[model samples]
Target: MGWHIEGTYFENCNCDSICPCATSGLTAPADYERCQVELAFHVDTGEINGIQVGGLTVCLIGDAPQQMSDGGWKIGVLMDAAASPEQAEALGSVFGGQAGGPMAGLAPLIGEMVGMESHEINYSDDGRRHRIQVGDAVNVDVEDFVSPLDPTELGVRVSGIGFPADTLAAGTGTTATVDVFGMEWDNAGKNSFSAPFAWAA
Candidate 1:
């Protein structure tokens, strides 16, 4: 049976504005010799194997080498604690790249999956502002840039990032941190992106 999900997603990374990985399709090297990122999403409406997973939040914590296309990333998953056992299992299959979807394309880039854990995930989306917090362990928030002439419109958007979405609105990370899986980062004032996404497998 196939699963389908549609939601809003955002991510923050320790990269300068206009990250090469995001813009160059992961063919370029990251700044500061490394890449640390947190990808967050809120499932507005979704189902995995008939299990409803709407209103749940998930985050992917990852660390990659300079050249992301070189293909070696240490990653971990944090799921909303509100999920039931069966829901968690189903959601994991979709995100773990076992169920066949956009995420499956990223499976080969993973060098190690640290683990998956349930946590009290707090995610909020208000237009250009997006935020995610998991207790005190993880925090990431981004604010999309807007045009000076018209503050309501996004300033930058690009296609082909390989994220489930066709185009992404670029932003700046106001706060980004992670303290899990023996990994820690204090990456603030970096690159960020937000977009509406739909995935099916």
Candidate 2:
């Protein structure tokens, strides 16, 4: 079987303006002794093993020690509640790195599986601004750093970081409170990045 998905992705973490994980290619230690972050996604169009999976949303939350590449990460997955059992399961395989797609590239960095949860995901888009809300569990929003010379463009565009897209827009958390899997953190004013994403296998 084969699978493919394409959409948008944005992430925020407990780093400064620019996340070291992005700049150092996952090799630098987090700004703090530990790391806390969330990767939220919205699938505009996709399928898994022939199952339609468009309009679904998912978020990956993690707590890692030092460099992200050092592994030993405690992570959790959150899927939208609207999905059927089959859809949910299919998403789990893709996100859990079982379907052997781009996500597989990140499997080695996971040390502990915190499991998955289902909820009504709310994803909002406003130009370079983005927001993710799931009841009280997650409340986060971010906006890209606009180029000083070109207010309509991102201040920075990074590439070759092994992320969703070859180049990503860098930003910072405006407000956030991520709580799930018994781990929580506030990413307010922390590092954030966003980009349009497309993946296949």
Backbone clashes per model, in order?
Answer: 0, 0
lDDT of 1: 0.88
Give each model's whole-structure lDDT. 0.88, 0.88
What are the per-residue Cα lDDT tens digits for candidate 2 across 10-74?
99998887888777878777898888999998988999999999999999998999778889999
What tens digits encode model 1's per-residue C-alpha lDDT throughout 1-33? Answer: 788989999998888886788787788788868
Report residue 82 deviation for candidate 2 (angstroms): 0.9
Candidate 2 residue runs with Cα over 4 Å from true position: 151-154
* Model 1 quality (TM-score): 0.95
Q: How far is candidate 1 from the true structure (C-alpha RMSD, Å)?
A: 1.3
lDDT at position 46, candidate 2: 94
